[model samples]
Target: MLRSSNPLEPTTASFGATDIPRKPNYDFERREREKTKAAESAKKAQAKAEKRAAEKGASDADQSGGS
Candidate 1:
């Protein structure tokens, strides 16, 4: 058997994902994106609310102690 001289060539699998046909669904994709964004926003808001509550409690304690 003859050996190949160019062994540095990249194979098809090394080029990343395989070719696959996908149907474009703009409405579905938009809804999914909106859901993800809303969930993230809600998580951030909850964390912010908790932080604000903690800060407010600490401030109240400090004020009452000084009185």
Candidate 2:
């Protein structure tokens, strides 16, 4: 059996070199979530405004046609 000559050298696992996991960036993740929420809210608000405008126009047409 071949063995490492230097005891101080790092030993490798049978699979390969061990990998250290990266730490999560909570601040960046929070900012991204906030941005997505804001965009969705804006979209919903725009749709609601368009629906209100359409209803108002239809009501005006009905009143003029009935007169």
Candidate 3:
């Protein structure tokens, strides 16, 4: 015999989730600072590489026989 499911019944367990201890001093500001620094460094490196490539292209064009 098949039993009918109760829609109102609690399916999951009521564990002590909210009872978890939090950090005494969370340095989210420091994490954001580091993230921004890393992003800026990457952007600078990308720009430098692009500039070098453009210089190289100009030099190659100058060296080529045909204009």
Candidate 4:
């Protein structure tokens, strides 16, 4: 019974296949959770890289100072 000028829009014709209202398939909650997780992961990786670089720089400085 959905009314729309666009014939492409969903109607009772496909009602048997879906139970939920027809709309874009986007899970905002899931996307937000994923985005948060990704940001945390990126932060952890950056912290690790910085720590490694700092260790390397310290080692280089120590070696130069000894010689």
C-alpha RMSD for every candidate: 5.7, 10.0, 6.6, 9.1
Give Cα distance to truth, residue 36, candidate 4, Å: 0.1
Model 4 agreement with the true structure over 1-67: per-residue lDDT tens digits: 5688988877666655856776665798789889999999999999999999999999999999999
Local accuracy of candidate 3 as per-residue lDDT tens digits, 1-67: 3333986655556533586787755488788889999999999999999999999998999889566
TM-score of each: 0.67, 0.67, 0.56, 0.59
Model 4 stretches astray by more than 4 angstroms: 1-26
Please identify model 2 stretches exceeding 4 Å from their true place: 1-19
Per-residue C-alpha lDDT of model 1 across residues 8-67, encoded as one tens digit per residue:
755444466656888899999999999999999999999999999999999999999999
Evaluate candidate 3 by giving its C-alpha RMSD to the native, one decimal: 6.6
Evaluation by TM-score, superior candidate among 1 and 4: 1
lDDT of each: 0.87, 0.89, 0.81, 0.88
Write down the lDDT that model 2 would get: 0.89
Better of 2 and 4 by lDDT: 2
